[model samples]
Target chain A: MAAKYELKLGAATREAFGKALVELGKENENVVVCDADLSKSTFTHLFGKEFPERFFSCGIAEANMVSIGAGLASSGKIAFVASFSAFVLNKGFEQLRVNVAYSGIPLKVVGTHSGISIGEDGPSQMSVEDLSLACSLAGFTVISPADEPSMFALVKQAAYHPGPVFIRAGRVKVPVIYGPDQKFVIGKGIQLTEGTDITLISTGLMVAECLRAAEMLEAEGLSVRVIDLHTVKPLDRELIGKAAAETGCIVVAEEHLVDSGLGVRVAQVVAETSPCVMEFHGVNDTYAESGLPEEVLVKYKMTGADVAVTARRAYGRKK
Target chain B: MTRTSDLSELQSIARTVRRDIIEMIGTAKSGHPGGSLSAVEILVTLYFDVMKHDPANPTWALRDRFILSKGHAAPVLYSVLAETGYTPKDQLNTLRRIGSIYQGHPDRRFIPALEASTGSLGVGLSLGLGMAEAARLDKSPSRTYVVLGDGEIQEGQIWEAAMYGGFHKVDNIVAILDNNRLQLDGWVKDIMGIEPLAEKWTAFGWHVIEVDGHDIVALQAAFAEAEATKGKPSILIAHTVKGKGVSFMENNPKYHGVAPTKEEVELALKEIG
Candidate 1:
C-alpha cells in the first residue's frame, strides 16, 4: 500500500511511530504507550485513542515516564515512552541510565523531534546530544530511522528486542525514501545509492538530504554513494568499512551536533577499520536558534547543499 | 491489629533482620545502616505477611513487586530477602563484594527478585506505578510496594511520580516512606524540610497514613489499609528513628552511610537481641 500523503513529502517519523504503536496495540494487548504530555506531538495519542487502557500520560514528567516504562518492561509488557528528544534523554538522563539501562530491561525510549530539525522550538528543544547520552548508557541500542516506513519497521523491531532501545525520530515531514513494505533490521545501515568517489553516510532526515546531495554530485560528473546509518550505537562496521574501502573517502552528515552523533560514530568506524579521509557535516558544535526546519538545516550546515560541499571536501582529501 | 502471635513472630523477624542489617553493613564497612535500620519492620511486614510472593518462584508474574527506591538501604532488602528464602543466607555477607550479586544498591539484573534497579533516588515510585499499571492491564490483583527514604523524597522525580500516581488513580501502588529523618549529611529538616509531608501526599490525592514504623502490627495494618483503599494510591509515612534498635546509632546521622565497627556491631546485635 502506498503512503496516504504525497510521496515527495512523507509524514514525520513520529507519526509513523504513533501509527505503529497503534498496530502493535491491536496485535498485542500487552503493548503499552507512555507519553510526557507530548502524546499528540509524539503521535502516541493515536495509540491512546485506539487502546486507552494501554496508554499512560505522565504529564510533563519525562523521568517518571521513563522509569514507568522500565516498570512495565520488567513486568513482561512492551512499554514505549515517547517525548521530545532533549527532554527525554537530557532531562530524564538519570532515570533512563539507572532505572532502564542498568536494569538491562527492554524499554523502547522513543525520542521524537530529534536533532536541529525540531526548529522554531529553539535550541533547548533540539536533541543534538541525544545520541551521545544514549551511547553513554550501557546495553542501549540506538536507532534513527531515515523515514516514515523505516520508523514503523524499526519500532516493531524494537518491540521484539530484548534489551533497551532508543529510537530518534524527527518532527518535520520528509520525502518517502523507503517503500511501504520496506523492512528494517536493527544494528544495520542501508545503502540507498552507489558511487565510487565518496560515500555520504547520514541518518534521520539527513538521509534524504544525502540522497539529494548524491544526485547533485552525479550531475557535476562526481560519483557519490549514499548510506543511511540508521543504527547509531552498533555502528554497522562492515558496511561502513566496505564503503570506506571502496569509496576511499567519506562525508558524514546529520541534523545533530557533529561532535557526538552519526558523524562522530561513522568517523570512529572508518578510523578503526579503513582509515579513510572524512569530512563532517552537522551542527558545528553550537546551538541552533529557532527557525523553519529547512532554514535550521541550512544554518546548521546540515542541508543537501551542505552535504554536497562536504562530500567534495572529502573527495579532495582522498589519496 | 495483627494476631498477637503473628505480631510477635514479625517482631522477632524484624529484630533478626535489624541485626543482619547491622552485621551486613558492619562487615562490609560501608553501607547506609541508619536508613536500613529504619526500614526494617516495614520490609519484614511486607515480605512475611502482606505480599504474595514465593521465594522459589520469585519471577511469578502475579507476585507482588517491591522496589527499594532508596537504594542505599539495600542492606534491609538483602537481609529480608535472605530471611524470606529468596536468597541464600550466605549471600548477605557477600554484599558490596566485587563478584557478589548482593550489590550496595538493588540491581534487578543481578538479583531477579528485585522489581527495579534503583540507587539514584526518586525513581522508584514511578517504577512502582508502572508495575501497578501493568498489573491493572493484566487484570491481576498483584500490587507494587516501593520503599522510599525521607531524604530521597527531595528528588523532584518522587513528587513527579506522586503526581502521576494520584492523577492516574493508581490504587495498586502503596509507597512506604522510611521517614528516618536523617540523610547522609544531617537531619532532613536542616537540609531540606519536607514538613507537612502527609498534607502534601494528601493534596496529591493519595490515601495517606502515618504510623510508627517500628510497630510490626501497625505496619501490617497500614499495608492492609493501603490495599483496601480504592480509586487512589496510598502512602504509609512510616515515622522511624534513623538508627533504630541500636541505642548508640539511634537518630544519628553519622551512621547514615558509615558502617559500624566490629565491637559496635556486637553491641548493636546484643541490643537488637
Candidate 2:
C-alpha cells in the first residue's frame, strides 16, 4: 500500500483541543468549558481567554469540576471539563460515574497529558488506566485521537453528540496523521494501510508508530495492515473483526497499560467475531521512569520498532 | 414571611409527606427512613411554596431546580414530587421494586423529572452550583436548591464545591443542610464531628442561615433571604431530628436505613396525623 498523506510535524492534541474549543465557543452560544486549575497545562486557557464568561475555573478540584460540568450540561449547556488524565478521570471517577455517566448528562470530559508520553512529570501524573476507567463507565463515548487534526474534528463531533464523552488527549507533539479535510465518525476506524499478512491496530500517539511500523515491515516485503483506532469505546468492532479475519494476525499498540488498554477490547472483538493470533504492546504492568517522552517510550518498549517486533512475532504465529 | 394559614397548610403537607415516607419505606422493606423523615418539611416547602417550579412542566427552563444531594432520602423527594404533581402518588409503593421509577437512590434516568441522579454524597452541591451558573449565564430567573445530609457533607467533595461556590460568589444556588445530626452508624458528632459548621460555611463565603429543619416558615424565610442575597451562595443549616414523627424512630440510628414494620408504619401514620 502506498502512503497518500504526507506526515508533518503538528502541535499536541491538547493544543489542538484548546484551539478547537475556542472555535466551538465562537460557533455555539451554549458551549461552555470547565477546568480544574490545569487550564494552562490542558490548553483550555485558550478557550478561557476567548470566552471568559463561558469558561469556569473550578480551582484544583477535579471532582467539583466534573459535577459542575454535569450541572451545566443538564441545564442546556455543552460543558467540557478539562484536567490531567490522572487527575480528572481518577480524582473525579465517582462523579463521572454518578453525575455524568449514570445521569446521562452530555458532559465532554477532556483528559489531557495521557499515558507515559507525559514524561518528566513521572508516573504520578501519567494516566495509564484512564481508557479502562472511562470505558468501564456505561454511556460514555471514549475517544483517543491520533493527532491534532483528528482531535479538532473529534472535539467538534463530541460536542455535537449528546452524551457523556471522554476524550483522551496527549501532551507531547507528534506527526500529523490526518489532513484538515479528513472526516471522522464517533465509532469508526481509519485504515491507513491495506494489507493481509498482519494488522497493526493502534490509538493515540501509537497510531503514528503503527504507521511507521507498517512502513518498516513494507521495506521487508511483508504486507501489513495499519488501523488507527481513535475511538476506544463503542469501538469499531467491524473494522477490527475484518482485519482479524483477513490478516489472521493482530498487534495492538497503545501508550497505556497492556492489561486493560485498547488491546483487551480489541482482543474481545477478535475473539467473538474472528479468532486471530494477537500480541499486545504497551506499558506492561509497570510504570515508566521520569525521562523525555521519546526516552520513556523506548525504555517501555512502546516505539515503532517495538510494535514492529510484536507484529512480526504475531505474524510468525499466524496459522 | 409565610402567612399563618400557609404555614399550617405546609405543616399538614409535611405530616402527609412523613406518613408517605414511613409507608413507602415500610412497603419497600428497605430504605433510609430517618433521613427521609428528616427532610420532609425542607423538600415539601421547596416543592410546594418556595421554588418557582411547575409540576406540569417539570423541565421548564425557567423553573427552579431541586437536587436531592442526600439521595437516600428519595422517599421524601418522591413523596413531595407526587404531592406537587410531578408524579403519581400510587408509585410511592414501588420505592425499591424491580423496574420502578424510584430507585434506592435518586436516578434521573428512571424519572426524567429528577434534575440530577444523585445517590453518592458530596456531589450534588456542585451539580446545583453548575445549574445556578447556567441560570446566571442565561440570565434566567431560576434558582437551584440542593438538600445536603450532615453525614453526606463529610465527603471532601462537598467542601470542594463549597470552596468554589463561596470563592466564586455563586448566588443563584441555595444549599440546605439537613442537620439531622445522625448518620447510619451513629450520631454525626460521635462518628465524625462537623462542629462549628455555621462558621465553616460563613468562612467559605456563603450567606449562612440556620433554621429548624422541621419549621416550614423558617425554611421559607431562609429561601427568600437566599434569593435576595447577592454575590454569594447561601446555606441554611437546618437543625432537625433524624426521625421527627415516629416515636421509636426519632433520632434512632437503627431507622437510618431500616424500614418500619407494618405495625410501626400504622403507629407512625397515626403519629404523623
State which candidate has the highest TM-score. Answer: 2
Per-prediction tally of clashes? 0, 0
Candidate 2: chain B TM-score equals 0.97
A115-211 in candidate 1: lDDT tens per residue? 8888899888988888888888999999989888898899988898988999999999978888766667998888887778889888888888888
Q: What is the lDDT of residue A200 in candidate 1?
A: 88
Runs of candidate 1 exceeding 4 Å displacement: A1-7, B1-5
In model 1 chain A, the worst 10-residue window by lDDT is: A1-10
Per-candidate Cα RMSD to the true structure, in Å, reads: 2.8, 1.7
| Residue B51 displacement in candidate 2 (angstroms) | 0.5
Model 2 lDDT tens row, A176-207? 98876788999999999899899999999999
Give the Å shift of residue A219 in candidate 1: 2.2
lDDT of 2 at A76: 94
At residue A310, candidate 2 shows an lDDT of 91
Clashing pairs in 1: none
Clashes of 1: 0
Proportion of native contacts kept per candidate: 0.95, 0.97
